[model samples]
Target chain A: MAEVKTVQECASMVADGASVMVGGFLGVGAPLQMIDQLVANGTKELTLISVVGSYPGGGFDIGKLTAGKQVKKFIGAHIGTDPALVSGYNTGEIDVEFNPMGTFIERIRAAGAGLGAVVTPVGIGTEVEENASKQSFYGKDYLVFPPLGADFAIIKAKKADHYGNLCYDGTSMNTNTTMATAGKVVIAEVDEIVEVGTLAPNEIGTPGIFVDYIVKGFSTDERKAIFGEIWQKGNKLK
Target chain B: MNSREIIARRIAQEFNDGEVVNLGFGMPTMAANYIPNGINVILQTENGGLRFGGAPKAGEQNPDLGNAGGEPITMLPGGSAFDLAFSFCIIRGGHVDATVLGALEVDQNGNIANWKIPGKFVPGMGGGMDLLVGAKKVVAALAHTDKAGNSKVLKSCTLPLSAAGVVKRIITDKAVFNVSSKGLELIEIAPGLTEADVKAATEADYQVATNVKTMTF
Candidate 1:
């Protein structure tokens, strides 16, 4: 039996200092409502892994958390978009490990698949080597990036069946599908929930077994408003 | 011609026949229009699909099948999707022949600093770092000056770099330059443009090639 709850309930499961994997690229496909609930809950000293930076800045969920100093460490591909994260990093308020985007995604996928480690040539002779281990195989150099799994994986999806099976629309499937199996507890927030077997088998992106809980909520329209603010700020720049 | 079209045509000339190429966002995206007729160059996009054609007609765009820049694109025959692992396997595995990218700045040591500025917030670095290391050759298409009319070709970047010493050549509206161990060597200048005119627009000291000629359209 799958238990459905609210975003607040999902946030309650996250304790202070928990390691979490968040799904999305920039603002797309992020579990905005759940992130908001976490921010409101005021859980501090967290380790966050995401592809994008904090949030869109001016009151976005990720940005607010970063600004509130809830996060202690961050591992991801880029932080250029989030002013709070960048400022925090530069000011030594937070620790950051920057992974290449593709490599970051692969590390999460490798964790989900229960792989110990994966080898790639992306970070060879680059700053990515600062944290990653390098090894040679068959006379070729490769960087060994460890698989990343979190205590909780929070993600957004388009729809879900009563069984907790998930479906994502279009490119929204980006990182959520892989993150489902990369965490000890997978919490999903969906816009719509249907009866069991309602979703076509072929449309199921993540099986119910990988998902631990489902949260029902509407993502706030804050992102569009934030974009407007950013655009306004950009227009004023010389 | 507009700056976009000029940079696009210049990048198209850099391609050899039957080469596999990846075009990063901005001016490099325009190269799809200028690929010579009968050339079988395959365009690999980091967003999962490969063999993308020219821009899609209005109402025919599928957001899921778009390029890295989120622009509507047409898929050529035999296009497919693989996970990020396999997509980069083609990249870091050295299957791509060349990659053309847009840059914010290029320094004397061939370093690119396109990912960020000190105070301004921009999207984080995408596949530029991976492509720079994976592709056999790197070509940058950009304007010679910043929007504030400052020179972007510099002795060294003040901003954080996306790739270190990987730029092979740069195709800009004012001139063409190749990065050598000895620093930036000017290979060509736009027709009717003088060496002094070009030098005043750039911050770096440039070595003029003896065989300078107008870039063929």
Candidate 2:
């Protein structure tokens, strides 16, 4: 029973201090229309949970929000691609909580699956071990990472049904599938929305039950235009 | 030959056939080009690609298929794409046979520090920590000294450590060292470089092997 809404209408549901999970690796998979709406709404003091920062160079994708100083804190694995974020962190304008890439997603997956914690050796004997609790199982030490859930998850997908079943294409599926379930209010932005029973069962990356709302985002042609715009802007530096 | 290329060529000799390997950014990425033609090694990009070919030409680039560094690459004959979860599972589940990475500092105890530098505002630890702790064999490729002529090989790391006591082999412009229970052991020195030059440049105490040879590749 997922509702279809405009990006502005869905973005209005977010409060000033809400914790948000933005799915994408840099810019490719970001829900740009929804993100633009959030920026236009002037949402402030948000806690952002993402896998990586915006694409290299600023003034596009999540870099727009970061440049606007809307995010108060960022929780992610890598933020190197965004200079604004680095400047924010250096100036104490933004607080950053860094996690190893695997542990970050695993924690989100743990929240989605209702699991207690993630125990693995990915961060053992390193700086990441400082915050984790150590336990010995199977004669090896593992750092236990806690689950990470958010107030909202803004995700991008290739297609979806009216029932909100999602299907992703190519690398865009990186973090969107897991973040869809880890948020209390999941908003999926897709290129096209079909009727119920349109998407086959095996093709769906995330089931409809996990999606609370669906918003029509940029079509493929529009996406290509936007990419061209951004790429051209980046090429000016070269 | 440039120092980076020489180091990359030297480390490329370590790859065994039928092994799954991951190369980190910077110097380690160069090893992909030097991998022997018939080695049959599979390259894994942490951004969710495996069995991928080397970097693609400018016009041949596919936007959807790129490495973790966002460089365009080609998919080999047996290449496959999985999500980030499956890619990391391959890393953390001990399926990656060897991982070559860059290092900022390495110590006699074989501890590595590469991800962060205090007051420098680094983006975040992307995959270095996980790769260091998870891979079956960890090989570090780096310059022997920092830009300021400071020794990068030290008695103990001064910067934040990425992982502790995990490095097994190190190939630098000056020489190659092996980490053992006894600490850093110099097994090979670069051509025209003597054991004394290595000792003078290195801050960490290391044992010179009884029969050290000049680097070949």
Candidate 3:
């Protein structure tokens, strides 16, 4: 059984200079309260990894951390959404590493699965190949990428059982499922927490064995309003 | 219809029945509204979820059922959601039949430069590289020219490329082009536009197809 911790408690475990993986596409599936708590705690000089750079609009979700200058380095697939991160990157305040989103997630999965490396053809003919090692298989070229793991994984899900098993609401499962396995300390922030056996096995997105702690971040209504606010605030791409 | 809508409508005609397609941001996403009535095009949102329907009404939005760009959508009868890695596998593993994306530039050699610009801030390439390299076909959908009346079909792209020699076709507001070993082949021009008009707006050297037709929306 997994112990349910407060967002503060779990966030406190993330020390300064630690490497953290945040699961989200833009701001979807992000552990909002936990991120806010980390920002509030003034965690600094952190290595942050995310999928879409974070919420398109400024100072929301993981964008807050970037804006707060808590992150010293960012590894992400897209940074165009957040103006602060963009300026920070352009001005050299934050070091940013770019990868195609598929390679980013697959590298994390490789770490958790104990794979040494994965060779992919995605970056073969582009500047994305500049940093990686190259190899050929079956008469084709591919870039070899090692695994990327983090000290902490912070993710958001719709629901969780006492045992830390998680259920993602839908597309919110994006990077959250993979990061759960790659983080040395996996913390899941969910909207609801239920008793064990309340969540069926097949429906479980991330098994309890991979999750180290569960944090109830919001109620269903609260999450709804949060999403509504995101739309109302013009943070959406559409 | 406006040029963007027209471009999207034209791109919609490229899909065959039951083929899985992924749409990129901006103009490429609008193609969803124009898929032919008889065609059942499956949508693959890169974050997760497959074979989904179009967006919901503003008040009907479901946060969990949104695309990679955060637009709300509906899952069809056989639609299913998977985790991040598997969703990418469907993309990187070549299950996607076609991917339509907006290109900043398409060169004479059919390469696309979409993710980055010279000194401007832009989003990083999310799944573009994998989609370009893995999908069976890649379609570049954009306007024929930039806002300043400059041609985007170039002798060579000045910006960074998303991938080299991956775009199979180029659909713009002015024309439809088939990318080939012999460079861009002008196959279809927009209604009210002529072959000479396409040539004047294009910087890349290309040949007109023998059977050139006006694009049908």
What are the DockQ scores of the candidates, in order?
0.24, 0.44, 0.60
- What's the lDDT for residue B50 in model 3? 91
* Candidate 2 DockQ, CA atoms: 0.44
The local lDDT score (0 to 100) that residue B119 gets in candidate 1 is 54
lDDT of 2 by residue, B121-162 (tens): 486789778788889999988899988888999999998888
Which candidate model has the greater TM-score, 1 or 2?
A: 2
Greater-TM-score candidate between 1 and 3: 3
lDDT of each: 0.76, 0.85, 0.87
Ranking by lDDT: 3, 2, 1
Residue B190 of model 1, lDDT score:
76
Best by TM-score: 3
lDDT of 3 at A191: 90
Model 2 misplaced stretches (Cα beyond 4 Å) = A228-238, B54-63
TM-score of chain A of each: 0.90, 0.96, 0.97
Q: Write the per-residue lDDT of candidate 3 for residues B81-193, one digit (tens) a residue.
A: 88779988999899999999998899889799989875674678888888999899999998899999999999999888999999899999999999989898999999998
Best by lDDT: 3
Q: Is candidate 1 or candidate 3 better by DockQ?
A: 3
